[model samples]
Target: MEHEDPLVTAEWLKENITAPDVRVVDATWFPPFLNMEKTGRQAWSEGHIPGSVYFDIDAIKAGGTDLPHMLPDPVMFSSRVRKLGIGDGNRIIVYDQFKFFASARVWWMLRVMGQKDVKVLDGGLQAWIDAGGELEDLPPVPVERHFTARVRSDLVKDANQVLAASEAGSHTIIDSRSPERFSGDAPEPREGLPSGHIPGSICQPSGELRTPDDRLKSADELRTLFADPMAPTISTCGSGVSAAVTALALARLGNWDVAVYDGSWTEWASDSSRPIAKGAA
Candidate 1:
């Protein structure tokens, strides 16, 4: 089944928030190293779009993995989102507190779990406020519903798969980390891990795909940004979060032959045996 366009404007969301089948989600999250005083849960508790539910990426992730916010198994994902009252028929709109940050991760997660009606709020919560949308402090009451999750394995990649992709000479491994980090010139936010990208990868910082207001660019702009249309890609970032930004942009450009490296640089750099590339890739 085809999915909706990956984004909705704040004005559009304002008009549609009340629909019976629409599920508005505040899927905000912050990396601890960023040192933000308020967490996504804190921000949502203070005020969020009316009737919106919070999706805690950190909490909903796979439990056994050492990596941060790794994708959960289908059973766990279906159970958790079902508890959030999101079911098969819902049209889900996910927005993060920051500009296009964690919301796309949630969007990708839902898509890979076989939910096609999901989209990210174009400019996120800030854009909502900028558009003069109303917010409320009270959390919505939860209603139980059954969500069916059928995992789409093609949308995700592991560290070994990423390595294979790089070595096999077909897939384009895109690193979404900042140039400095990707080049080994800056220290990683997580201590004890080396700075650098996987060998043979290309650097495309996630922020470059967005505008000054933090909304993503148009399809034409994205096509120019990607340049090469033929390469199937594996998106990677410091800890798998920002890679979703690239994945989302690719999807907006109608390039679905893409997968996100779930472990990302955090997993690759941690391993001493993995080949690391420095200086502009």
Candidate 2:
């Protein structure tokens, strides 16, 4: 099966801004701790890509689940994207205002839901602006389209799989949180959760995979970053958001056997029954 490139440059997007088969999505989001004044919707209202729609990462989460922004059911995901005028065959380009933060989550989510023609905007919204791309404050009138979702189970993992991986030592569990957070020295952004990482997991902060300008590193650098080219990886982060960055980086290197722990540290730390490790893997 053919797959999308997984990333697109600002120039490519700018040139294809008006293509009928192309759709731009603003997936900007901030963590609770950032306390940003503007919501993702509000920011899109103020200014966004000319024909882009805002993909609310938090709003489209799985209902009836307490976990934040967990992947929704296939039916719900299809419904949400259809409303955004995203059809099965459209080429989706998702970008976020927060550097490389939340955009990859949407990219991962879309791909896992069987939409292979989606890509994250490299360097995100800032890259577009830096390249002299224009932003439109007016929201486009969305034309309803039919969307189909077929969940790719291999791309996602739950606590049980992670625990098994930790115990079996057959898979690599990579934590993408900061060193301070991974080591339990810094407090978790979400209150009440204990700081630290899962046992037998290695640390690879998502920020380290991106350049200072937020663009991803070259394939050679990424191959070096991930020395174990053959290990099955399960990525985790504060609440599964940044973990997607690690997953995206791995995907860029043509590694498709990776999965993200949906509940991540938030879920693992909440349960005292789960094994936790502090100060290095």
TM-score of each: 0.97, 0.96
What lDDT would each prediction earn against the true structure?
0.89, 0.88
In angstroms, what RMSD does candidate 2 have relative to the true structure? 1.3
> On a 0 to 100 scale, what is the lDDT of residue 256 in model 1?
64
Tell me which residue pairs clash in candidate 2: none
Compute the lDDT for candidate 2. 0.88
What are the per-residue Cα lDDT tens digits for candidate 1 across 55-93? 999999999879999999999999999989999899999
State each candidate's clash count.
0, 0
Q: Cα deviation in Å at residue 24, candidate 2?
A: 0.6
Query: Top model by TM-score, which number?
Result: 1
Tell me the TM-score of model 2. Answer: 0.96
Candidate 1 local distance difference test against the native: 0.89
- What's model 1's lDDT at 232? 90
